[model samples]
Target chain A: MVCIMKFDNEKCGYCGACTSVCPNSSLELTENKLIIETDKCDDCKRCSIVCPLGAFLEVEGN
Target chain B: MKYDVIVVGGRIGGSVSSLFASKNDLDVLMIEKQPEIGVPLQCAEATSEETFQTIGIKPSNRYICSEIHGAELHSPDGNHFRMYPHNDEIGYILDRKVFDKSIAIQSAKAGTDIMVKTTVKDLIIREGKVKGVIAKHLGRTMEIEADLVIAADGVGSNVARMAGIDTLFGTKDIGSCVQYKMVGMDVDPNLMQIYFGNEIAPGGYVWIFPNEDGVTNVGVGIRNHKKTAYHYLNKFLSNFEATPVEMNIGGVPLSGTVDKTYTDGLLVVGDAAGHVDPLTGGGIHLTVICAKIAGEVAAEAIKGEDISAEFLKRYEERWNDKVGNVIKKSLKYRKVLDKLNDKELNALAKFMKGRDLDSITSASLLGLVKESPSLVRHLKDII
Candidate 1:
């Protein structure tokens, strides 16, 4: 059970802000697409906080 | 066991060396420390098509991510310049792991024995000339003799140093880098973004290479003297809206090549030789090219039964004649680049904004010095 970050496409601007902040490399951009690797995700929440559009949501209590 | 040539570190350079040696009917053995040939890939894998053609390698779809039409340069102040293909030539970003393994496979087909999970602990030196390597596999250390040994062991090559080749590189000579592979990245499918400024990556730049698989490999590299690369890239990227899915960290030795890449019975190629371009920090093209040179030279030496420093100097001479000037010139540009502040970089961006200038090739960047001739006059010696 690990905490995870999810992206909200509606609020996402596709600016690549969150992907760049992550140190653990849990997040990736695919064809202008953003997908998170759950196993690699440390759930640092840097992505959620850095999203200017407020598109990132944290799933707690994995 | 004895081989005609024993190659250490089976990446592009090592494999290329083995391939050439084997193709020339020399007994070659390639030893790789990694369990898999190209696993846990360490490179960005982008190289010019000219490299592929020269190496006689053709990618089989698994290796190519995007056929780069050109590169887009963005300044800190948001000014931009697009450098289209000068000769309608497209470069490519590859699946490096696959590409490396493919080369090793090809070398095997050409008759080079491939050994993975095998580490070369030290060089077997006698009478001040390299003869072979002391390697370990399956918890057993063994000696493999060879007429010549090719060292392609990447940036921090222990083999190079053990073989009595000096491996000292200046702090300014290295580029530290970090990258993120983000999925669902909504980037312009065609263009690769190169961001330059002191605030972004002093003495270096940030790059966003979009892969065709709906992912973007976002990375930043900076000189060692500047702030930590991760710090700046993380800070600057906080302003964007995309989320990171994966992260990668690596280093590129971006200075000109070492004074000598070859010695008695020894040759160092690729990053081990500091063969990266100073201006663009691109090493793939040179790595493959230098590997080809090392391969050809080692083969010729084996065929002629001459492996002296004088004989092996052929490889050194050949590279200098073809790509040496470009490397020497780029180091000069790197010196000029290190002197620029944020304001100067911003002004540089503003200066070239929307002018439809030529490509950002090595020559074009140096050409900028012509407009401001006095700015880099002190660097004329290296330029």
Candidate 2:
């Protein structure tokens, strides 16, 4: 299975909160952009929990 | 490009670091990732007179949006109280859009070169010592060398981690925050207001800081919740007749400073180093003070010709001497708040009403213990 998290770029505020709380070190946020390290993610919902705009969503990945 | 210092993330911490480093006659460069300094501000913009004094700058009328004389506290059960951090001292609600640029301008005037629209992709590390940074601006990359690198990159703190320091904050230590710059808020013009409840703010509180005239900053900071802070903030705004013109989202480190803020040729300050009041999540004063020390210590180390970690440790020592006790005490208070239930909060709020917040003593805790054993037991841990 691949990374099960999907980010809604259109809805994201790009605040970088998700990057700080990611226990697996799987998120990166630069200026006006957020990059998710999918390979390192462990399906942790921390990003979804803290995202101010509800931009992160869980999905079944192949 | 080479310089004596490269200050990353040009907010208050970066600008202050570059400003002081330049003032000490060191060639300094400050790099800000944002296209403009202070656009899309993440702070509630509240700070005290002590901040300006420590930076040795006069508070300009251009950035001072409102002067706060005191604060009002609210409990879940409708109990309320008023207090101030210091007696007979004024605070400020700033237009940070202007204040941040003003500090960057000051840094520039002090001979520190500034680069906007620049991002540090990685640090230059050799033999486990930070030598410089590989930065990119608008798709063009360059290796800029420096004797010292100060990481002031706010909460993410990616730069410090590149130097092999553990700056990753767990969810428990982070406060997910959202704020709106609102107009038509009907609140006391001179007093900032705080509302508390687990159901209301979950792990944090809601603040309605009145700006000059009718503008106010209404916000909420929540921790470790499934629902977002924006949801709680919107719920809180329903009671007030306000219109939001702008929104800001961010996180705060409330678990106090990281175990280490310095490494070989690298220093961390501001929110990156967790130089924030853990209880209040206010880093404005602490960041200014700590970043200034970082700059001075960097300059001192360079002048002494020892940029090693052993010599740079003085930054941590000096800052800890100045504000360590304050953060320690605030951490204890935050722990006490963490253990309280809504009933205990209401009881404590009622007991402390009309009493000076700073004057909570053993006698007061004893009086409170008589009412709620659980509440005072946790509060006693702080003593």
Candidate 3:
């Protein structure tokens, strides 16, 4: 089982805390957009843990 | 593969350590987890000209964004205190990516091998001694051996933890920070501003550092706050009409140094060792200072074939001799600042209204505490 990642555009302050903590380099903020490459994400939920804005949400799926 | 020194994390600390070691004719390897050396900049990027002079590096214009001579401090009640340097440039805003990469390039030229996109899984320890590391690079897990391993990895240092060092900092000791690179704002490009208040930043302060291109890094850092740093930053941004070009956030360990920075065959430097300023959250200068010591000591130890904890203690002793007292004093000041209410902050600002910048040293801070006898208790740690 894998976790589906959801990002709230309005809520994210784009601080890149999530990107910095993601062990797999699965998340990135480019041009003010938060990009999450699902294949590289290993369901660690580290992004959600470190995000100050709590913009990342992990849902069980796939 | 083997090397005389393996420096983890390719940022300023790791790169400088590698450079100094290689300059001493030691085989040094630097490994960075990121694909690129300095992408996703995580700093407010402000440092003094003295920092470069201390590191013995001539200032490069390639990455200097702005030169500053003064700063403005704002209290919660709209009181402001202005400070100016007596005779020289006091601060600078940096293009961190360019600055960091420039140092890395210099290290490479000094004969250091650098590997990017390599993630260190764990330390290779045999019989209570750190032997090397196991890392994954380009889909291959490889074991790299080194006589000495220098952990310059930032605050979330895996190397220190894997070595069984207690790197945990209390929540009150961590500063949560969020910053935005903004443009099209009406701000004095020459003055860095710091705002203080409970409503603005609970246990920390807000800063607006302007660059030469009219872009500004506006940010907030708070300690022991219930809300997230971005929440406060978003609220602060609501007051501005500027457009944000980029956003960066990270946690700074404001606690003093870790319990121990050196073990047999292993040394921790930079944020990994919690060398950041407790009051200002600045680490670049301290990182470079400590990394330089680490490099020199590691090179000498390897040369003498004595990479033992007792010998490595010199790195810690030299760094503490240079900056330990300042850090301790700052931590005492931070504790005093933490307990101050908005009214008292305004009062302190009022007292500082006419003070000259050069006169406001740590000793002067003690004098300020004397003015407010209530604050005298906090000086026990400082005095």
Candidate topping DockQ: 2
Q: Residue B374 error for model 2, in Å?
A: 2.0
Against the native complex, each candidate's DockQ, computed on alpha carbons, is 0.02, 0.73, 0.14
Model 3: CA > 4 A from native: A1-51, A55-62, B85-89, B357-383
Interface RMSD of 1: 13.0
**Model 3: fraction of native contacts:** 0.14
- Model 3 Cα lDDT, one tens digit per residue, B1-383: 99999999898889888888899999999998878887768889988886687658888789988888788999999999998777766788888889888889989999999999887778888777788889888779999999999998777566877787766555567677888899976788888999999999898999999976879999899875557778888888898899899988777778889989999889999887888889988888888888888899989999999888899899899989987888888888888888888877886787689987455677877777767755545444544
Model 2 stretches astray by more than 4 angstroms: A1-3, B358-367
Deviating ranges (above 4 Å) for candidate 1: A1-62, B356-383
The TM-scores, one per candidate, come to 0.80, 0.96, 0.85
Q: Is candidate 1 or candidate 2 better by TM-score?
A: 2
Candidate 2: give its CA RMSD in angstroms.
1.7
Clashing pairs in 2: none
Docking class of 2: medium
Query: Who wins the TM-score comparison?
Result: 2
lDDT, candidate 2, at B11 = 93
Tens digits of lDDT, candidate 3, A1-62: 87777777877765444553556656645324676787897776655655566676767777
lDDT accuracy of residue A59 in candidate 2? 80
- Report the lDDT tens digits of candidate 1 across residue range B1-383: 89989998888888887888888888999998878877655566678887788778675688888878877898777888777765888888888888888889999999999888887877888787899999888789998998899998776566777776765454456666667776765777677889988778776888888877787888877764324566777886787767777666555667688778888889998878878888887888887888888888888998898999999999999988878988888878787867766656665665566544453355755766755544445434643
Residue B337 local lDDT, model 3: 88
Q: Which ten residues in a row have the lowest lDDT in candidate 3 chain B?
A: B374-383
Model 1: number of clashes?
Answer: 37
